[model samples]
Target: MNKPLLELKNISIKYDDKLVVKDISITIQEGEILGIVGESGSGKSTLIKSIIGLLGEGGHIVDGKIIYEGKDITNLNKKELMVIRGQSIGMIFQDCQSSFCPIRTIGNQLYDSMKAHMKVTKKEALERGEEILRELNIKDPKKFLNSYPFELSGGMNQRAGIMMAMASNPKIILADEPTSALDVTVQAKVINELMNLRKKFGTTIIIVSHNMGVISLMSDNALVMKDGECVEYNLTKKIFNSPSRQYTKELINAMPKLKKEII
Candidate 1:
């Protein structure tokens, strides 16, 4: 069996006094895409946030372990955790705008990211950023780099966010609704781009989204969550084609599909 790239053992999270995520365990192997589907307030985002140690003052891990590359990272210090994040495990939020700084130019942000992790000159960083942006299918990478976050379209921002997450060549990428803001055509392009990333870099991915269609199309394994608990988890084909749980069935049925044609 392949060793897991990342594993959560009975992980639970609490915000203030509320238990946002129940005891949940999941393992993601190298080069696999794991899709987490849930309704609003189902604790999907909370689970992702906890994995990267983003829980603020009122939020914390109540129990369990987080293992990455055979190391138990749950108890790592702030400085160590910072090194692990982005450098080893990258993340993309639901809102692309939030991932970037409002005051900094896109080029500067990417430059800082590259400079922080690797000993590279500013010119090298800019070249690296442009290379990634082109890989993500952004047109006119030079122009996009010069523009601020607010100047680009939502789709462009989404692609840029994905590029930023991949700049470090991390082991895992956790994406939360990566294409939620784009139009249908653009969303498809973005999804296809992400699906190709695994093949290009052998990067493990954990995508959290409400879109069942996208999940069914892209994931190898799927997990359904509700009310802060995992209701169902299985192979993606099995989960979509023959859901064992009622909630999973409802989610599958709710997915948009082309109308059946009468022969």
Candidate 2:
């Protein structure tokens, strides 16, 4: 069997000396989708952020190791982490529109990002960006690339965000509530696009969401978190059908029947 692509061994995170995530652990294989699901302040977001070293101000990993491809990266410096971020691990934020700069054309921003981790020129980056946009089934990839973030609708911007994260062809994509801000139709589109990405590139994905329905639909395995601790971790079908914890069952019960049935 192939070794796990990423591993979180007893990870504990803190902000300003206050522990928010405690003893959370997960193992992800290549081309697999792992969903981290929990309610607000459940530390789901914080736990995901720690993997890519994005836990902002006063937040730090107090214990445990983050092993990627069998290497310990728990204490890498900024420069070291920077080299790994986009080139090896990509991230898609919840508010993708806000993540983009209003002044920069989408193409310009994409070029800059690609340039940072690659030796590609502006023209090359734009070409690659357009190719990915086309693959995502975006209409008129060239027009969308030239358009600014504000010029696009929320759903379009979210797609652009996915495009940007995927530009590097990283092994893993860490998406934090990537579809929560969109309507149901748009959410389905984004979710389907993400699934397609994995199928096409064999990219491993770690998606964090509060929506149990989303988790059930996208993930191969589920890690259910509550108050910074993992209450349950198992195959998605097993968790949905036979959750071992009350919290996991409650989350499933809260989902609409339609959504549950769809899962």
Q: Find the number of clashing residue pairs for candidate 2.
A: 0
Candidate with maximal TM-score: 2
**TM-score of the candidate numbered 1?**
0.94
What TM-score quantifies how close candidate 2 is to the native fold? 0.97
Q: Model 1, 1-263: lDDT tens per residue?
A: 89998999998888998998898899889999999999999999888878888877998899999999999998788878778885898888778887799888898898888777777787877787788787787778888888899998888888878878888788899999897777777778888888888888898899998888888878999889998899988899998778899998887777655101100
The segments of candidate 2 whose C-alpha lies over 4 angstroms from its true place after superposition are 257-263
Instruction: Tell me how candidate 2 scores on lDDT.
Output: 0.91
Say which candidate scores most in lDDT.
2
lDDT by residue (1-263, candidate 2, tens digit) is: 78999999999999997999999889999899999998899998899889889998999999999999999989999888887897999999999999999999999999999888878999988998988898789879999999999999999999999989999889999999998999877887788989999998999999998788889899999999988999999999999989999888889888876375434
TM-score, every prediction: 0.94, 0.97
